[model samples]
Target: MEQQATAPRPRSIAPVDVEQAEAALIEHYPRLVRLGYLVLPPALGRNRRVLTAHALVQRALPRNRVGGAELTVPAPRGTDGVPSEPGYTYVRQRVLRAALDAGRPRGRWQPPRPGQLPPLLPRVWGLRLFPRSGGADELALDQALSSLSGPGRAAYVLRGLELSDDRDVRRVLSAAGVEDPGAALAEADGVRTPAGSRDTPLLESVEFDPCSLQARPTDLMRRRQHTRAALTAAAAAVVCATLLGLPGDGWGRDGAAAPPYAQNAAAEAALDPAKLTQATSSAWKSADRPGFATWPARGDRTGDRELLRRALAAWARPGRAVRVTATPGTPVGPASGPPQLLFAGEVDAAAVVLLHDGVRVVRYAEAKSGEAGAAALDFARTDAADADTSTAIVVGRTDGNVRYLTAPWVTGTAVRDLLAPAAAGQPLHRDAEGVTDATPSPAPSGGCRAWPALRLGSRLVTDLGELVPARLTVGAPGSPRDVAGAQALAGWAHSACHLQSVRSQGVRSVNAWQFATQPLPGGAGSAAWLCTRAETWRGAGSRVQAQFQVPGSRPGAPGAVVARAEDSAACGARDPHVLAGVLWKSKAGAWYALAAGSDDVASITATGGVRGSARGALLAVPARAGAHAELSALTTAGKKLTTLR
Candidate 1:
């Protein structure tokens, strides 16, 4: 885990300063632009959109009356820095509201007002000496968003771009005159461009100040030529057929070697079976080094790998029509039956098949006729030799990501113990991506999410079975996070990660507990975070009986611990489990703590000390701290689970 630098937290609202206000606005200016772009639904042109977005941010900041007449506005601030009420968050909500006002037909204000600067005829940024690359993705998204109704667009942007929770999302929808937040959420989920695809990331700025941008007339003309040429090339790339055209001799409008306008040999071969066979067996004019499969299979191997490879190779060829041998053998693998061709007969015309023998998996199209083919053949042979007929293959679009093969949850003591609550109707939980593995890959180096860990029920189950919880950290922040909650438990699970705007639902028939984050005192990019832990139990079936208790943790004033040792009357939860630990400052002005879970809730007689039914055990290093740092987690049962440093 990376250490978080402790910065002083504002205990209460302070008078605003001009420098601080400008700095905050400048720092967050890009984010405001992104939010504005999404909120308005981008119907206006780029420059207009940028100008309008800035105007919205101006309206959203904090304002006060000067001399009981003129209004003086300042940067916003709020109490305790809750995601719902933080200063930046407050301004963001107002911007969203302003966007709704500008975008809707019946909105309070009509945007594209005459006061904004007119669109400049040219983009100087596009006039670079080198050809500027473009993604058709942004254009696609703009079109998609424009088609949505104003409210739906607002909901999508808030949930998709702003990363608001269902609660915040619901509020936005309400502001837009929509009553069903859940349905709106589901609809947004359906229409939104997927997260990891070509969708324009909301964090990046694509618009520039057109008024200040400059370019020479010749360069501008050249840029226009390049733009048309690039579009032409891109259009050509998407087409499957190769028509007659002058070969690579001509310079494209952009002054680069035009892609050779030659026919696809694969397409030519597919029109004739004999041609297909000849093409598959022919040696490549320029072959790369040997890899996974470049050779043939042995005598006893039931499957004709050579034939399979050739068939798939032929299948992958453009404009080429191909088919498997009339009948495939009962090759066993994926299931207890014959060899399985996943998505068999349905491979996209542009795609090929992949074969795996439970050990080494290879993309058949990538196989060569020598060492690579031999390696692939050997892989199948070895699996067959062991009588493991679990050979199966997956077919899909050709992006190089390799999805790991997984098996059904095994019936074992470990699986049983962790899911013990399921017998009481407590649904088992996994991440939305399905049962990927026991743990996920790693935290994306760049993104909103941060690292988190937890222990549940008195015993924490592992691959080896339920035992004391492991010392958790960022080591495994990827898939297959331990299943922690169902809908009932999930209600309170919100505290685990208040910072996360997007969320994952149930998988493996269970729900994995996820976390939310808050910005570090410095700014965006996750650094410091505030989260909590709790113990759960089932009374009747899988319902996380109202008895489940959540411990409270308040990280305030930089690295200082402002533990909610005592519950306030406003604490609305049914079971307000209180955890306690010392707040110690370190010599270097950093704050940290080493603590264990003790069920010792302090009693009325004890003088500000540890107390509670801290039956659970814990050990964590909560970031860095100045002076002597202390830590603890307490239970609502009046027991204190504390560790002092």
Candidate 2:
């Protein structure tokens, strides 16, 4: 993992100084412009809002406040040092908001009108100086710009000419033109010349077009002529197509359809099956390669010589076999039986199938995971010749991401263990497009679920299994402490017990011997129980369980060593079976839960139990050691329900 760098300290500089602000801005202006341009379209280009935003922010400098002492806004910082627009993010956000607001419809605000600007016309160029030059088009553009209204011209210059946003364009128009140009200009980026001026055509600011004359001018005069012709042709074509109803360029002169353009012949062939098969086969057999054929079964060595010759010619090169064998799986398409294929070694998850035709083929198998490994991808097993006919191939998910494994044939084990989980109750089918392994909409019957129980001690236990006295109780009768209440035995069969989550009937707390069947080791059987000093407590309250003894010595009782169960109490409630560890919540809203394993649970057990139990009885304390217990107190108001000790 990459380590994060420590943040730098704020630069000590006077924020109010406009000079410093400008200098800072100048340093970061390129980046700001690039970011702003990236966010907003260039067709709307640079205008007064951006310029004003730049200036206002620049003047405010160091600190983004009107007066430095009044509101000392901290300067924004970059990697190396302080930024010119210290709070550039804030300023940029504001500018972006304003720019967006300008685009929306409101009572007062309106889109600006579009107009052209004079094209660049150098004095050096004449009409005949360069015969094909676009001088006339340049002149026309200049004339168009000259004729546009002042507001229209300003809008075009700021937005279209400079390639800035509409907000900035509006600002420029306001600054350069009338106080409020208002509706004089609408949608002001490109020049929209009025229709039907037979004698004079306006040019200069043209609409965005990749094939526009501006980009294609070879000579000045030619460019001018071409642009004029294009416009005239477009206008005439529109009228002709709409009113005259002309037949467009429906077909080529020869009336023969031309082949569509393709990037490469091989790619084009791949798109067409007929061409692809022919090309592949011809290319494969034409090379100066040994000949090979499918091995035919020999009876009494009749075709044995022929088969050997075929195999040698097709596979053997110099001395070694070129192709290994035919593919082992059933042929996907129409075939006599399973397709025979020459096997190459496994590459990652894909099984390489080399054929005598020297064609490269790939077959994938869904890989089984969790057998053993550090990384998830390492759980794949590669087999050279998996020719089992009973096992079907288990393909990976779409995009072939998951590891795949293939059984030689269709078998129950292959389907149950490998395919079933990976299939995730998905539909399976083999078609020309390979395999369709889609997740079943409604999951298939017999979906996978958590196993019955985990092996704690020796017995097989279920969630509903009874909790007996042996599982909870510690020592024999009349021992020094008697190991009563709730407590875990240090060493015994009781230590190997675990209780899967079970639904309780009602509020119950007892310190008596109860045989409880629990999860077994290796997650196999359902047999587990504990002796005395072990208690199962539950409730979202403090005062977990009270002790008839003292304040800290062995409180109410010990609890079950839960593995992955969630329980909490505001009082001193600890898990009975602290094997998997215990979790407790304090009245102060502090949480304490042990980490996984025996060591952590041992730590929690050392702390002992609480002196009392909470009101909300979400727990059922089932302890070993014959001792009668009863709920002492119960809360009456709100959702708080605690059991009195």
Candidate 3:
């Protein structure tokens, strides 16, 4: 959250042209951060106020950065006191809701013991924007804002500043996790106009620009820029130091439309039913990437395995979604297959229990990895799920892959097409369809079976995007619209806080998944070990440095730690991102990494040791941490061009 322009925010909730939406977001950038500054104080902490606000803004940046679709959000009120702006109210309400939700106290709420809790509205440290220049006035406002309950505070902000209709404010409040909307409304009404303060003191003031509160830190920003440039130059100069680039943003194909794959879908390699049960199995295995392990392996092969497969199929019904996963280190109990009670990877070693309900809401309880996962919950009971809720729920992986359920019945074709190519040459089951049915598939006269038939004509769809008159595809489940009829339901409400709370969780979760797969960075080495804590202060995201011991680099020489990939899942044998580096040490025992590259055969053979090959050259010099030396460039083929020492 540096005092700099950040990734763009969304401009509208309603589907609009992508470029127009981006411009709208950029136009409101400053105001958006200010709103975030106030709302996110609780979650991000007031201490690093600037950074936290920046983080929230950055978090709102869509997944596909350059050109992508927009997410669903409550449409703005046309000049309802507040001037009209596309996505203004939409982004604002979402930012506020995100802050409130993030700042919400976890677990059953209890008043903190007198001395147990830190003071409410502790003084803001990093960056402050307000009426008091960090004086009593600012503190008073902070006290007032913090004093209000999460929903109460949100409701107050909406009505007071947004001038949102009262009903609309309350509706948004309910969407922000208020169990009782009426209670939240009552609380906001009582404090709509506090005794002596205006709702938005900082915002309503003439001196509202945040820069007025503090001078720019040009030196720090400049230092960051220079450091990256220097480091990149040194990295690019080495033989094996490969290039890294951000992911492309195109969501769908342009130019020419290929023939619909459904016609030729038969050519796809057959899927292996047994493969689905393995922790490391996928229907879409390819030479460059591993098959996804989210989907269950073959069903109908065994009693419990068949049940699990039937459960997965039922969950994938049109309205249901579910994906089963096997966390690493979990015991592969006998060849019997993973049961409902399997180890879940978590800090407290929680186990993820599989639910029979057709929707997915992977639940974790307070327990150890191998100790839990036994108890399952009704899909409705998990995170506001209701009777129409899915028996199983599906979630997408960091890569655009999903293993889960849906509602209604479409023949097994959808599941088959969605599955990784079945094991290349396996005999096909003309009726694999029944096993993959969203509706419960009957067990072949046998061992185990799924109980209770699915409720018909009771499809669950809590999202408004899909229900909207003309739904947009850019952002969904994460779109801001929490309810379809909020605006009209709230008689006096001008703006609806179209919310997609799932997006909030999705943004953080993707990084969590990305960061979790560290042991697999495709570096060629004897073995790599974790050497440092994950440092997330890299401005963009967290990263950790690790080293693998390359035997012949030098006697007693340990491998040098280098930048690890943030999204290692996308990297593979042909990874363009460099992976491992050689150790350059001085007699004084200080060491530095001269260069790093993929540890694949050619790269490892070329860059590992001082003893060089005709096709490879080792650029060696006495280097220490933060120590820079002139570097020479080499072609990918290892041909040397003398540029500098």
Please give the CA lDDT of all the candidate structures: 0.31, 0.26, 0.32
Candidate 1 lDDT over 290-363, as tens digits, reads 21122112112114344343433333331111111110112222211122232112121112333432333323
All candidates: CA RMSD (Å)? 23.1, 31.3, 26.8
- Stretches of candidate 2 off by over 4 Å are 1-351, 354-426, 430-578, 584-605, 608-645
- Give the runs in model 1 whose Cα sits over 4 Å from its true position: 1-23, 65-85, 106-134, 173-186, 192-645
Better model by lDDT: candidate 1 vs candidate 2: 1
Candidate 3: regions farther than 4 A off: 1-13, 41-45, 64-74, 80-83, 105-138, 174-179, 192-203, 206-212, 215-645
C-alpha lDDT of residue 1 in model 3: 69
lDDT tens readout by residue for model 2, 1-645: 998432222222343444544554566554443222222222222222223223332332434433233222223333233242533433432333333333333454544311111113311232211111122232223224333444554445434333234544444334332344343245233444443323432222222111121111223533555566566666644543464354653211101112123355433332221221112223323434212222111112222222222222222111111112222221212112122332222322232222222121223121121111111110111122112110122233211011112221212210111111111111122232122222111111122121121111221111211111111223322232222122322222222222222212111121222223333223333323322232232222111222111113121122344322223322212322222222333344443332221111111111234222322322223232322333232222222222222
Candidate 3 local lDDT, 433-455, one digit each (tens): 12211111112122111111121
Clashes of each: 76, 121, 56
Q: Compare the candidates by TM-score and give the number of the best one.
A: 3
Candidate 2 least-lDDT 10 residues: 372-381
TM per prediction: 0.25, 0.16, 0.27
